[model samples]
Target: MSSDLFDRIAAIGVIPVIAIENAAQAVSLADALLEGGLPLAEITFRTTAAAEVMATLRDKRPELLVGAGTILDSASLDAAKASGALFGLAPGYDAEIVAEAGRIGLPFAPGIMTPSELGAALKQGARLCKFFPAGTAGGPAALAGISTPFAHLGCRFIPTGGVTEANLPDWLAVKDVLAVGGTWIATTSDIANGRWAEIAAKTRAAVARVREARGG
Candidate 1:
């Protein structure tokens, strides 16, 4: 399951970390992403409407790989699952949450920055992780430094936060990077102001860069 999600995400090479302010924007956002050659979204739990957004995308645009992010505990994971999220993501590692997700058969990815955290996730049998706040975490340089020890390992990374079209290629150039996460494609202001065309254009540019970087 992890490999399948990894392949799908890598194919597009970007995961839009979306924070939808209203459920009404969900379907249109999914359509915009599809039009831009990207169909993956992590509807963050930062807002009250996240789950609704996730469910709307799932039911309206079944082809989109919709999931829940900012998942901090088992309850949040359960809520995400109930909302039809195919997977769950968190910003930090928690053994209890991971255990619960495993017991429930949910494919999960915990956030990791330090080598210690990476080792811990590996011990927990997690092959993919989110390198959150990727820019503040040293961006591609930080990823390269930490990935050195686990170069032979099969672990892959999804660097989120601070990712942009200008620097996305840098992250994709890394050996173990599967995909990148960013809010630039569809910012809160963009959605609030109903700027779907701007979002679609940005998605196209991001996808183009990913294809160029992967030599696809």
Candidate 2:
């Protein structure tokens, strides 16, 4: 199930990390992404409004693939599940969180920055991991270098943080990177300012970039 979820994510090639401060904006935001031909969204737990917004999107916009990010503990994981999130993303790897998620059969991707962390996650039965703070972790070049040893392990990555339109091609060009997560597509300020059209436009352009890079 986890592999299948990652496959779907890879097919889309991008996941918008969004934080909707207003639950009311959830449906329209999802509509905008659908309008742009992208239907995946990762709503982060950085705000008090995250759980409700996630539930709103899940219940109302059933076609939108909504996942929860910034999940740090079992509590957040439970909340994410209770709110109907399909998956959970953490800023870093945690053994207990991985165990609990597996116990409950939740699809999860823990953040990995170093080879040691990757090894640990693999030991915990994780096949896909998030290369978080991707830019600070040395961008695509760094991910390529780190992925060499793990290539045989079939470990794939979804690099988040500081991923933008300008550098997306470089990230996607790395064979091991299945997809990327970026907030630049629908930033907090953009949502606050009600810039749905701009967000949709950026989503469309990002999707075009992915297709061009993959020769699709």
Which tens-of-lDDT digit does each residue in 25-102 have in candidate 1?
Answer: 998888888898888888999888998898887788999998799999777888898888988888888888888888
Worst 10 residues of 1 by lDDT: 1-10
Each model's total of backbone clashes: 0, 0
Clash pairs for candidate 1: none
| Model number with the top TM-score | 2
Candidate 2 at 4: error in angstroms?
2.8
Task: Please provide, for model 2 over 49-167, each residue's C-alpha lDDT reduced to its tens digit, 9 standing for 90 to 100.
Answer: 99999899888998988899999988899999999999888889999998898898888889999999999999998887899989899999899998898899888889998898888
Which candidate number maximizes lDDT?
A: 2
Alpha-carbon TM-score of each model against the true structure: 0.96, 0.97
Q: How close is candidate 2 to the true structure, as a TM-score?
A: 0.97
Provide the overall lDDT of each model, using Cα atoms, as 2-decimal numbers.
0.87, 0.89
